[model samples]
Structures are given as structure tokens and as C-alpha cells.
Target: MTQDYGFALARERGIALGPIGHRIVEENELTRVWEVRLAPGEELGFHIHYHPYYVVSLGGGDNEIETIFGKTIATQEPLGHTVYIDEKRAIHKLTNRSDQTYLSRLIEFKAVRWTYDDDPAQARPEAGEQTPEGYAAAFREILEHTADLPWEPKSLKGLYQKMLWRDEETGASIALIKFDKGVGIPNAHAHASNQFMYCLSGKYRYIPTGTTLVAGSFYCNPVGSVHGPTIADEATIFLEIYDGPHYPVQPPWYTDPKDAT
Candidate 1:
């Protein structure tokens, strides 16, 4: 947590493994995060990255990862579900396991060379409120927003994102997102920080599990979880937030489908 750019044992292995659609969204000298999207029926050919990743399912669709022997590995669904993949010899490919089409979004968190703990201490209960006091504000708003319109993911139509608030001084970010009905974001990829999201609209069929993440649900995608391209019956809206300045750029690796193995 010192925030220094000193080298660590992790730096010895440069670049990462993954397919073409994979790309970085945020990066700095110290840490970096990549965002990858996969459409329904699309596959992120087998690859690997030398970092821990947190996969955040934005909307509809199932996420499936398989090993070289065609054995099942990791799977996930939206409504805030997450999965972790280490950047060691974790070789696998991602696909939308659902019959429905959707967009999958992933944020990969890569730390700098040095290791440090940033763990937050456990919270104690407060006396009065039914729910935690800090979360009460969001809980109350959820009731107000549920009855609102156009909630579902579509290929086209409705607003995509709305920034709710931000604390530049503290590096805290928050926003509201609406995915069109019957559509998804994209495939599994990596990024640099822990991500949190909550659903506040129509239900979305989660990837990998084919479950539904509707209003009043929240999820967290830690460090590195190669998540999915989500999907939904109609437009679904949710809150998207993350801790960033994720990680720095990495050297390119091979991504050809034929040569991925």
C-alpha cells in the first residue's frame, strides 16, 4: 500500500496470455486494469495473464472457461457474481454459455511489483438501523428506482451510462449504467482494481449460470475475474463503480486463435 513503483517478483514475467478482443481501459506506472467484452456465442480463445483478475458480470449471459482437456474450470453469472483467475499457469478460454445473446464486461486488476496489504478491518454493528447505516442511503434509493422505465438490455435503445457522483480527492468513483434490452456488453478480460456494481432495473440472465440479477442486488469483482458479456430480456440499469489507477501497460502476447494454445 506504499504506492511505490518498486519491482516485485511478479514483474519478472512480462506480458500476459489472452485473445485479440482483450484490451486495457485504465493504466498508470504502478498498476493497470484491462476491460474485455464478448458478444453472445463468441469465445475468448484460451490465453493467460500474469496477474490476478476479478470478473464482473454487467448484465445477461453465462461465462464459461474450459481447460486444455475440455474440462470445466470457472463459470459465473451477473447480478454481481464474480470469479477469480490467477495469472500463473491458469490456461483457459471464455464463452457465453447461455442460449441468449448478451454483452459481457470484465475489469482486470493488476498490482505493482511489491506486495502490501490493503485489507479493511471488519465492521461492527450499529444500534438503530435495520441495514448498515452507510448502505441505507443506497437501499432507500433502490426502492424509488425499481418502478422506473425501460429496464432491460437491448441491442439498441435507452441510455447507456449516467455518472452519479465522484470524490476526486479520495479517488472514489460511482455511476449508473443501463444496458439495452436483449443485448450484452462483451467477453471476459482483465483490469487493475476491485469493482462493485448493483442492479436497479429489469432482470438480466447471468452468464455461466443462466440466472437472473434483478433490482435490489449487488456484486463485487475482486482483483482479477475474467467476467462475461452480459445479456437481458429488456433494458437493465445498475450502479457501476471501482477503485482505479489500476495498472500499467504490458508487452503484447500472441492472440491468434490457431496459435493460442
Candidate 2:
């Protein structure tokens, strides 16, 4: 004989279990990334999310999500997909309903300031247009199938990105970047914002850290931190969340061979 976990019981007792099946891959002033895996019939026990966050699905599968209000939503998440949830204090539980295991990367944003601005390059929805119903209504704000988003090429060759979410006021943005195999930029560059990178697939070497990062590895470079000249050993896909806009300053090593005056 076993006790059944029911919705009423969970709400009444406050769902004692908290974030099961999640491993902290990395953390910094700006973000915390968790690598999560749940086998069939496993659940990441009820937990509260106090900050804005995003989830990148590494393995697609069926799942059931129960909100603190006792509402349940079933979804079929796709691999490589990403979703963003606005900051709200909310509790929820997730259960893997598929026969296979479910894998995902959860990135939580901390210390974010939501200052609304009207920058043409920042294409996020207007604050007024966002849900006014609070955290309970934020369930509808989740974006799915992020891999289907269009890729925008940066100034760097052989590198492309898909901007997922951006906040003009805070200058925070989330993006998925792809690097072709053997793509190496010979520059020790730095950015104005803090950046956190999580390797979703493939392998690459971060020259500054002298570390070879593979799938599930993470790296953090704070504001004004100088690093890079990344070399990809294989086609690599990684998730990057930064505090401000990306403007990589060219280093002396990046000088053009044609301008050798």
C-alpha cells in the first residue's frame, strides 16, 4: 500500500520537497544554471522561483506541471527549445510523463532590473502588454521551440546567434549561439556586461581559462573581464545570458593582416 500525492494534499502541506533531480552546474552574481534530469515517473518536487528564469530543453519529452494554485498543465517539450518566465514568486512542480528520461538546463537570473525602454534593437514586448495578472498568469509567457528561431549573424565569421529575450533597461539578454567546427577567432576580447555560458552540446576550448568545456560544462566571465579566442573542436551550441549588450572590443592580436603599416 502506498500514499497517493494529490493536489489538495500538496497545497495544504506546502509541497515539502524542493527542486529534486537538479544539479547546480554553475553560479555567479548574475545567474545560476542547473542541469536537470528526471527519469520516467520522476518529479522535481515542488519549489518556488523567486527570480526571472529560462529553461533550455536538452532532451524532449512529455511533462506535467502543477502550479501552486493546483492547476496542472501538460506539455510536450522539444529538444533545444527554450522558455522564459518573468520574475514572480511562484511555486510549481514538474513530473516527467514520458517513458524515457527528461533533461533540461535551467538558468535563473538574479539582480535584474526591469527598466522599460524603447530601443529598436530590443524587441521584447512592452511592459504594459505583458501579463498584469501576476505570477499566476506568467505561465502563458513561456516561449517554446527556441531552435526554430531565426539565427542572426554577428560581426564574427562562422558564428551565429538566436536572440531569445532582451531587456533594454537592464541590458540583459539571452541568446543561443552556434559555432562551426574549427572556428577560432584570434582575439582576446572583453565585454561591458557579465556573461555566463553553458555548453549544451559539442566541445570547445576557452583560451583565457585554459579549460576544455564539453556538454554540461559552464563558464562565467564578469563585466570587463578579458578572455576568449575560443576554438571549437566540433560543431558546438551554447547558451549565453549576459547583463548588457554584446560589444566585443577588438584586441591587438585581431589586427587586420592587410593593414600592416
TM-score of 1: 0.38
Residues 80-109, model 1: lDDT tens digits = 555665534334567877665434444443
**Model 1 ranges off by over 4 Å:** 1-17, 86-89, 102-105, 112-261
| Tens digits of per-residue lDDT for model 2, 91-141 | 578989999888877877665523212212223456777633343332335
Model 1 RMSD in angstroms: 17.2
The residue ranges of model 2 lying beyond 4 angstroms of the native Cα positions read 1-140, 248-261
Specify the highest-lDDT model's number: 2
Task: Please give each candidate's TM-score.
Answer: 0.38, 0.46
Candidate 2 local lDDT, residue 239? 91
lDDT of each structure? 0.52, 0.67
